[model samples]
Target chain A: EPEVTQTPSHQVTQMGQEVILRCVPISNHLYFYWYRQILGQKVEFLVSFYNNEISEKSEIFDDQFSVERPDGSNFTLKIRSTKLEDSAMYFCASSKDSNQPQHFGDGTRLSIL
Target chain B: AQRVTQPEKLLSVFKGAPVELKCNYSYSGSPELFWYVQYSRQRLQLLLRHISRESIKGFTADLNKGETSFHLKKPFAQEEDSAMYYCAVLGPGTYKYIFGTGTRLKVLA
Candidate 1:
């Protein structure tokens, strides 16, 4: 099975610094999404992208957060200023289409210091 | 508000015993339900979906529209079944999935 792969399984960034989380979604998938799970909390949806633009986003995806499909295969999530509350396991997922089940990546564990 | 709820934070069952992980949702419209499992440090893998109505790894979940529940059940549990399971719902007008807090199942040998 083609799986979504994320880079830097663990990331430690200083507060107020910019950090980018990278993900390579399934080659043939069309819809991409970003979700985060804070320790002991339910997984929260961040943003969903399709046709090279954002289709939907949650309140947690504020102005400080942005997502881009810089290329055909790379879907990146950038945080302009890291906050302590931003520490969590960030997961990237992709599906063939809106109706298909999304396949999730291993997740990047972001830790803010 | 649309939400998925897994009341039990943790459930333990001995090998060969039956297992049931409860899930309930609060969605007015017809919703798509799914069960995803994460083992140890692995990524979330789709165990089953309500639409397919297929059994995967001896696990099955029925969508009870009247009860607003989609509880996962397995006739016989195995040690390998121990993992974190999450119930998610996607409503008619949304592409984002609302996930439950997740239940940690520990199947003792």
Candidate 2:
């Protein structure tokens, strides 16, 4: 079965530095999403992308955060300046349509020092 | 606001015993609920969805409108069933999902 793939299974960066988490969604999926889970917390939605634009975003996805499908296959989340609270497991997901089941990647564990 | 509630943080059951993981949601319109399971060191995967009304891996969940619950249940728990379970609801129109805190199940041999 085709699955979403994320690069750098784990990332460690200094505070105030820029960080980019990359994901390659399922080949034919149309909708892509990003979600994060703080240790021992529920998964929180970050943003969703479709049609080459952001469709929705949460409060946590503030000015410092941005997402782009720079290429037809790569979906990347960039944080201009990292903070301690930004440390979490980031999961990327994709679906054929908005209402279809979203398949998730293994997740990238981001740690800010 | 749409939210999913999973009251129990952890549950333990012996092999061969019955198990149930509770989940409740708050939504005004008709809701779509799902159960997602994450095994150790594995990515989160969809276990079942209310719309399908089907059983997978010997587990089943029924969406109760009056109670506003979609609890996962297994007639006989197995050791492999141990994992973290999350209850989620698809936001109406928005296509976003609201997930619960999750319940960690430990099936002892």
Candidate 3:
């Protein structure tokens, strides 16, 4: 089965540094999403993308955060300046359609210190 | 606002015993509920959804609108069933899924 794939299974970066989390969503998926889970907390939605535009974004997705499908297979999330509270496991997901169930990647663990 | 709550943080069951992982939600619009499972060292994956009204791997869930619940259940527990379960809720017209804190199920042999 084709599955979403994320790069740098674990990442550690200093505060105030820029970081990019990469994901390769399942081929042929039309909708993409980004979610994050802080340690010991419920997963939280960040943003959703489709048709080369952002469909919806939570308040947590602020000016510092941006997402792009720079290429056919790669979806990247960029944080301009990292904060301590930004540490979490970031999961990328894709679905054939908006209303269908999403298939998630193994996740990229970002640690800011 | 939409939210899902998994009251139990951990649950233990013996092999061949029945098990139920409780899940509750609060949503104003029509809710789409799902149960996702993650085994150790594996990615999170969908186990079942309320819309299907069918069983997968001997597991089933009933969406009770009155109680605002969509709990997952299995008639017979197996060791392979041990994993972390998360209840998720999505509001109408959106794909942003909200997940619960999750419950870890342990099946003892």
Candidate 4:
């Protein structure tokens, strides 16, 4: 079965640095999303992307965060300056279309010092 | 806002024993309910959804409108069934999915 794939299973970064997480969603998926889970916390929605633009975002997706579908297959999330609290497991998911069931990747574990 | 609750953080049962992983949701509107599972060292994957109404791998969940519950259950446990189980709810008016803290089910062999 086709599944969402994320790059760099784990990442180590320093405070004030920049990091870009990458994901290649299922080829036919139209809706993409980013969710973060802090250790021992609930999974929080960050943003949703459709038609190559942001469809919706939560308060957590502030100025420092940006997403781009630079190509047909890749969806990327960039954080301008990482904060210590920004460290968490960032998951990328995609659904065939809006309101459809989403498929999630294993998740990229990020740690900031 | 909506929330899903899976009260038990851990549950253990021996093989061939019946199992029930409780899940409850707080949403006024009729919403979609799903049960997702993640095995150790594996990615999170869909275990089953309420809509199908068909058992998958002997696992079934009934959406109880009166009680606002969508608990996952199985007739008999198997060692392969050990994993992290999460109950999720998608509100009718919103696309954001609210997931329960999760219940880790361990089917002892």
lDDT of predicted model 3 = 0.95
RMSD of each: 0.5, 0.6, 0.8, 1.0
- Model 1 ranges with Cα > 4 A deviation: none
| Candidate 2 chain A, poorest ten consecutive residues by summed lDDT | A95-104
Give the DockQ-based CAPRI class for model 4: medium
The per-residue C-alpha lDDT of model 2 at residue A75 equals 99
Rank by lDDT, highest first: 1, 2, 3, 4
Residue B35 error, candidate 2, Å: 0.5
Fnat for the candidates in order? 0.89, 0.76, 0.89, 0.54
Clashing pairs in model 3, backbone N/Cα/C closer than 3 A: none
Lowest-lDDT window of 10 residues in candidate 3 chain A? A36-45
The most accurate candidate by DockQ is 1
Give per-residue CA lDDT, model 3, range B1-109, as digits (tens). Answer: 5778999999999999999999999999788999999999788999999998989999999999999999999999999999999999988888799999999999999
iRMSD (Å), candidate 4: 1.2
Give the winner by lDDT: 1
Q: Rank the candidates by DockQ, best first.
A: 1, 3, 2, 4
Full-model lDDT for every candidate: 0.97, 0.96, 0.95, 0.91
Which lDDT value does model 3 have at A25? 95
DockQ, computed on Cα atoms, for candidate 2: 0.86
State the fnat of model 1: 0.89
Docking class of 1: high
Ranking 1 against 3 by lDDT, winner: 1
Per-residue lDDT for B9-109 in model 2, tens only? 99999999999999999998987899999999999999999999999999999999999999999999999999999999986687678999999999999
